[model samples]
Target: MISRTLETTLNALALYAIAAVLGVAFFDQLVNGELPCPLCLLQRAGFLLLAIGPVLAVARGPRAAWYGVTILAGLAGAGFATRQILLHIAPGDAGYGAPFLGLHFYTWAFVVFVVAIAASALMLILRQPDGEATDEVQAGAASGDALGRIGILLVILMAAANVLSTTLECGFATCPDDPVTYQLLTPSGS
Candidate 1:
């Protein structure tokens, strides 16, 4: 009973995150036309990785298949968060540069990345039996697997929403032609 509840919670969180990310991407990226920075895109990829874990568990009737994927997602999120924070703090010298500290976008991405890492950590460590999360997802004795399938299906829909948002935002975040490029080659005139 405990395991099933925990797994369900974890699954809910993962799907919820996907939906949130997708929502942000749509409103900020699709509507605004603002593109993601390199780090922003990296974070999106991290979210995708995290989404894989729950999806696998739901589709395959087992969560074990996504263990490594979850860890990788956490690492990716951590890496992107670190990079964004550093970039915000440090200035780039030449064509390769960092954002001036205090960009709203950077701050938002950092927060999301942190949340993703925490969520992934919890999901990976939570207890479950055998490779399959089967017994846990089983509905009370009478209902069988219908509820389980419905839950999994809901997660899938949420995941799709996330993917759609990321795709839209990722397409716009890359700003290649800024006039004032920052890199070691060219120090800031200001």
Candidate 2:
């Protein structure tokens, strides 16, 4: 069922997003030469997972590995988003936690997290297994749910990486020591 062109499209988007994050990391670590703070590293990890999640889903099918990755990626996104909110919303605390408070990166990541979880959940719930009906949702769904799943995952991963980095490396929303940089070159260590 996933072998169709539509599935290929989703896989492409997921792969592209994953590759972009890797590219950014390469630039930061290799080309630009930067180090990742704790939070930044976490975010980069989340993006890697995000990129891998949907393709895995596509490969194994919704009820199989896809569901597992969907849940995992969603949870990771939620955790990252929640952490940023807590740090940014800390009442009197003004330190490394609130790094992205003024910047919209925190806000954007939170939104993406929620959206990704929602989309993954919706896609999983709405999608029928290979043995069942696949045409029902496509004919009924008009929101591009089928087409947008990968895109949504990509967005979530991108935000998770950047915002997570911001929360970790920056102090009071400012860059800090050993700050991580990002690039878009390739796979090998640069």
Candidate 3:
């Protein structure tokens, strides 16, 4: 039987984990000069979507509906990552972007999404019966603790960065299938 406070704390931790993944992806993009492919963008979007439930759970007391959102988003993200993996599975084909820790980002994304789904399911199964929130949970939710607030802010910042980067990379045009440069940053004649 998980207390509301514990549940909220877990949700905040999940947000932190998601933000870490996004942070690494953003760092790789900027530092490594690796432009994300369309599939990679979709995978990132999936991760952002996965954060929605945790954000809501932290802001409001834990709810089954919120976890459901996380599960659905994780499934979508896993699918996108799988698609990218399969695309490069052919013999002699080099995968997109550089491999990190011997596995491509897409493969890592798939792993993260799966783990999130499993964790959300376990959380749902262990949640307190009748959606009851203890006094502590209610107070925490109302006041918003520092750790949870910081986690939420981090995810929000990462999401904003992703939006700005994607807009610069693709502009108003469709993202190039194999993006090598930022569309909006490059001269039209060049």
Best by the TM-score measure: 3
* Candidate 1 structure quality by residue, lDDT tens digits, 1-190: 2365456445645666665665565566555555555566566666666777766655544354465676677677767767766755655533223333434554565566566667556655665645454554451221224444555565566557655544443333443433223232334475
Greater TM-score among 1 and 3 belongs to 3
Q: Which ten residues in a row have the lowest lDDT in candidate 3?
A: 134-143
Name the better of 1 and 2 by lDDT.
1
* lDDT per residue as tens, model 2, 46-86: 65566566655443433435546756875786687567557
| lDDT to native, each model | 0.55, 0.52, 0.90
Any residue pairs clashing in model 3, and if so which? none
Q: Say which prediction, candidate 2 or candidate 3, comes out ahead on lDDT.
A: 3
Error of 2 at 148 (Å): 15
Per-model RMSD to reference: 8.4, 9.6, 1.5
Best by lDDT: 3
Q: What TM-score does each of the candidates earn?
A: 0.59, 0.51, 0.94
The clash count of every prediction, one per candidate, is: 9, 10, 0
Count: clashes, candidate 3: 0
TM-score of candidate 3 versus the correct structure, residues matched by position: 0.94
